[model samples]
Target: MLRTITIGSCVSVQGLLVGQMADGKVMVRVDEKTYVGYPIPSKRAA
Candidate 1:
């Protein structure tokens, strides 16, 4: 199933994947909350 995930902190999801930083976790933001996850990124944009 596909879903609409939000940008956690300021990490780049479509351009950059700078590995954990100040926002040391990948997460899903919805309704003012964050949920950590190991995003299985399919492909990146140009």
Candidate 2:
């Protein structure tokens, strides 16, 4: 599934859901890189 995550107060990233971290963060892949950041709940989930 595709998800969005916030890396900072103003930075947000959108990509395919990779995996979840134990610290509550989620991993996302935009192209070839994977980023781990705090997840922002999607509208469907909220």
Candidate 3:
């Protein structure tokens, strides 16, 4: 299934999680970004 996986505010309007990188950093396509220290859920499955 395809679900919207967002990094809260760590991404931008032009950013995208284009698969994961080798170092675990999500390959995002963006110019600048904003970071928000929010609690991210570990799992969203119910």
Candidate 4:
């Protein structure tokens, strides 16, 4: 699955879902690199 995460206040990344951290952060891989950050909340259907 693909997920989007925010690394900084203005920086966001979208990549393949790697794993989830214990502190509520999530891991995502872009190309050969992996990044850990807070996942963006998905919008609910209205």
Candidate 4 error regions (>4 Å): none
Scanning candidate 3 in windows of ten residues, the lowest lDDT window is 33-42
What is candidate 4's lDDT per residue for 1-46, written digit by digit as tens?
Answer: 9999999899999999999999999999999999999999999999
In candidate 1, stretches whose alpha carbon ends up further than 4 angstroms from where it belongs are: 1-25, 43-46
1-46 per-residue lDDT for model 3 (tens digits): 1123345655323344445546444444444643222222348578
Q: Would you estimate the TM-scores of all the predictions?
A: 0.32, 0.84, 0.27, 0.94
lDDT of 2: 0.90
**Ranking of all predicted structures according to lDDT, beginning with the best and ending with the worst:** 4, 2, 1, 3
For residue 16, model 2's alpha carbon misses the true position, in angstroms, by 0.6
lDDT of candidate 1 over 1-46, digit per residue (tens):
2323235545433323334435444544445554554455557698
Model 1 gets an lDDT of 0.43
Collision pairs in model 1: none
34, model 3: CA deviation in Å?
16
Q: Which stretches of candidate 2 lie over 4 Å from their true place?
A: none
Ten-residue stretch with the least lDDT total in model 2: 37-46
The root-mean-square deviation over C-alpha atoms between each candidate and the true structure, in angstroms, is 10.0, 2.1, 6.9, 0.6
Clashing pairs in 4: none
